[model samples]
Every structure is written in C-alpha cells, then in structure tokens.
Target: MKKTITAALAVFGLVAFAQAEGDVARGEALSVTCSACHGTDGNSADAANPKLAGQNARYTFEQLLAFQTGDRVNAVMSGFAAPLSEQDMWDLAAFYEAQTGTVGEADAELVALGERIYRGGIVESGVAACIACHGPNGNGNAPAGFPRVSGQHAAYTAAQLYAFREGYRAAEPAADARMTDGESMMMRSVAYKMRDFEIEAVAAYIQGLH
Candidate 1:
C-alpha cells in the first residue's frame, strides 16, 4: 500500500509539471504563426489589425474560440482560428499576454479632449466613462475580460467602435450574458452619442496609452 501510494504521488507530480511546461512550450510555438498580424510581441504593424499585447488571457482566449466556432466573424481570423484546439487558444493567449505593448503618440488637443471624455462621461448624452471598466491607464482588467485598450492603433479603435455601434459585430453567445448585456448597451449608447471627431479624439488618446 505504501509503495503504491508513493508511485501515485510521483505520477501526479509529473502530470502537474507537464501541464505547466505545455503551456509555455505551446505558447512559444503558436506565437510564430501569430507574428505576421500581431507582430513579434503582439503589437500589430498593420493599422487594420488591433494590437493584442497585454490583453487579458481570458479575453484573448474567448475571442479565439469565437473565431474558431464562427460566433465572431472575421474573414481573416476565422480561417486562422478554425484549426486551433482549445489548448492552442490558451497557449496563444498566454504568449500574447506575456508581451509588452508599444505606445503611439497622439495630438495634444485630441488627447486632452479624449482624456475628459474617457474619465467623465457626457451625463446628458448617457455616455459612460471609458475608464470605468478599461481602467485609468486603459490597462484593462483580466478578471473582467476587458482587453487592454492602451497602445492600440487609433484607426483600428475607431473602426471597431463604429462597427459595434452599427451592429456589424454580434455579441458572442458564450460571453457572460449578464456582463454582455450591460456592455453591449453601454457601447451602443456611447457610439451613438459620439461624433466622428469625438471618436477620433478618443482613439488618439487610447493610442498614446502606455
């Protein structure tokens, strides 16, 4: 009995070690394919692609799953994610989250205006502060599954915000239903309330975040 128990414990230890190693090893390997769009360290060189560096692992994983399952429809990402397994999603998230993000510069006036809007919502317009969930520095919260908005491309950000407003993207079915409802409503409201100039200003501010 003693010998059997000892052997079982040893096996358990090995299994645990392997699991940890798998995450790291798989993350490294999977990152190679991602570099073309997400850059070497998760920053995208293409203005059309959003930067993924410093994004929450949960958020990144969910997005990957969405693309794989056809819940989120992006022509390019759908093809890429279709072949990934659950483990691949986890590993890719780990890799991207581990990288440091690049920051962009914003116009002074736009930054100032964006800062005010981000911190203080337009109450009359029913606009909510972007910082409430995205954090003061836009670093985002992992637990909340909020992707880091800091250091994103201004054009990409504006486009996405506009898309969300126009209902071009549908909510993920697997997303936390409770949070999704509130988030969806807030985003929709904010998008309608914002003008093109406001979107530009906000995007500029977001790009400059470190």
Candidate 2:
C-alpha cells in the first residue's frame, strides 16, 4: 500500500512541479490589496477566510484560476480574481507561499476521533485516509498540488468539506455552484461518505496540526 501510494503521488507530483515559477518580489507588491482579508502576510484573522500563508504556490495558483474561471464559486473570490492575469495570480501565490502561518488549538474531546480518521479511513464507508495525500504531519504534497492543511482554520476547512459534499450530491453542479474540487472530485468523494460530526472533528484537529 505504501509503495502504491508513493508511486501514485510521484506521478501527480511530476505534473504539479512542472508549473512555471512566479516572481515572489512582484507577488509581494501585488499583495497589498489582498492584505485586507488575507493579511499582509496571508495569515487571515477571520476564521471565515482561509490562511494562505505557507500554502504551496501551485495550489494557490490553481485556486485563483478556478475562481476566475467560475470553477470555484465564491462571489468575493471571483471578484478578486476576475481582473488578475495568470501571471498575477502566480505572483500572488508565490508571495503567500513564502509567509508564515499561525495555528489554533484543537478541541481535546475531538482529537482522538479526528486523528483516527485522518490517519486511517472509515473502511466500511470506503473513505480514503487523508494521510495518504496530506502526509502525517499535514505538510501536504506540493508536487501533487495538495494544499497544506496544517494550521488551517477549522471553520474554513469544515465549510470547504461541506461544500465538497454538496457537490458530490449534485448530478450536474451549476457553474455558480460551490464545488471547489477539480474534475477528479476526490474531495467530494471522500467528504460525501463522512458524517457532519466527523468533518467537524477532523477540521478541529487540522487547525492544530504542525
């Protein structure tokens, strides 16, 4: 299983790594407008907004493009992303990737269940272990374009999971729908089988991941 996971990640990583590099300095200059929500360093104070600090450049770039293209539907994100060029997106991604992120504590009562689910899947439900893709430490797979889950806000993560689960139920999700997962629908598939409490638990655990 380990070998298989590694092999699959390697293949995905290759594609992700091929993305062109962006100018970090230029990205920083362009980040001023983004500071209102994401902070000057990308660490958002609001739980509703995700902390982009320490996120991989590739993932950030892809999300920006998705917002612009209407693949991910958020009115605010679309508005922010609409006018930006592809290179501008890359620059912003690069800038955010370089910043540090802060984390909050996890709820002790939920830790056990969350850790179990993150490391081991719900076999009966056919759910895949998050560790297979996000890594045990939650650093995520940069080559695979997986965003870091460590230190992320629980509220934000839970919201995304719920959104993905909703997408899973849609026979044909509308363009303005809130599905953020790409064509693979991996997130939706995993989230669809998870209970609400499970999502909440894991999200809480992720907030405290180092």
Candidate 3:
C-alpha cells in the first residue's frame, strides 16, 4: 500500500510540477514587497505569517498559483500574487527555498502532547500522523510538493490547520475558500479528523521540529 501510494505520488508530481527550474538570483531582486510580511531572508519575524525559508520550491510555486487563481484565498497574499507572472512566482519560490529557516522554542508543557500528535496521531480519531508526509525532522517530501514544516511558526501553522478543517467541514466550501492540499484533499481529510487541541499541539510541535 505504501509503495502504491508512492508510485501514485510520483506520477502526480511529474504531471503537476513539470516546469522549468527557477532563477534564484532573479528571485531575490523580485522579493522587495514580499520582505514586508515575510522577512528579507524569507523568515517572518511575526508568528502570524509563515516562514517561507527552506520551503519546497514546487510547493511554494503551486501556492502562488493557487492564490493567483483564487483557488486559495488570502486577502493579503492574493493581491501580491495577482501581478506575478509564472516565471516570477517560480523565481520567488526558488529564492525562498534557498534561504535558511529558523526554529522557535516550544512550550515545555505542550511538548509531550504536541510530540505525541505529530509523531503519532490520535488513534481513535483516525487522524494520520504528520510524519507520513512531513518527515521525522519536518523536512517534508519535496518531490511530492509537501512544504517543509520545520521551524514554521506555531501560530501560522495552527491558523492553516483551522483553515483546512473549516474548508473541509463546510457543506459547500466558499468559492474562494483556502484549499491548497491538491485534488486528493489529504490535508483537509487529516485536519478534519483532528481535534482542536490536537491541531494546536501538533502545530506547536512542528514549530520546534528541527
């Protein structure tokens, strides 16, 4: 079953991410506006925003496309994505992917619960462990378009989990609802089964995963 899933993912990645590689040098020049929210080096100081440093290029490009197409809606991000051409997006993705990511200290009190949720999902709830897609160190599967979660802000991670869960639970998702997990809706499915506390726990764990 694992092999079958891996094969499927490879095929999907081939079709979905078949694009020219980006120019990191050009990308740096294009990231002036992005530096406002995300730091100049792609690591956001604010916990509300995600740190883009060390993210998978393909994943970042796909997200830019999603925002541009209105498949994923964010008031701030959408506007930024609107004027960007495909090459521009790829360049920005490349630039961010080349930067280093930093980790924050997790709450000692939350580590046990958080680690449990991240390394082993709540069994009764049917939630899959994060390590399935994101590796043990939160590096993520680059070829499969999984973004690196290591060193990501807990607040941002939790917000995204909430977004995924809310989108999944809606009887009919809003046209502009955020849903970037791809056609399989894997993230939505997993997040839907996760309890609120579990989401918080896992997000906290992910923040300090590295």
- RMSDs, each prediction? 9.0, 6.1, 5.6
TM-score of each: 0.80, 0.88, 0.89
Backbone clash pairs for candidate 2 read 13-143
Instruction: Identify the runs in model 3 with alpha carbons over 4 angstroms from their true place.
Output: 1-17, 171-177
Whole-model lDDT per candidate: 0.70, 0.80, 0.81
For candidate 3, the per-residue lDDT at 182 reads 61
Model 2 lDDT at residue 40: 89
Give the Cα-based TM-score of candidate 3 against the true structure: 0.89
Candidate 1 local lDDT, 123-193, one digit each (tens): 77777899998999999876656678998999898887776565424444322121122334556567767
* Tens-place lDDT digits, model 3, residues 97-200: 88899999887778789998888888998888889889999999887778799989999999898888887856443443446676688989888888888888
Clashes of each: 0, 1, 0
RMSD in angstroms between candidate 1 and the native structure over all alpha carbons: 9.0
Query: Which runs of model 1 end up more than 4 angstroms from their true locations?
Result: 1-22, 168-184
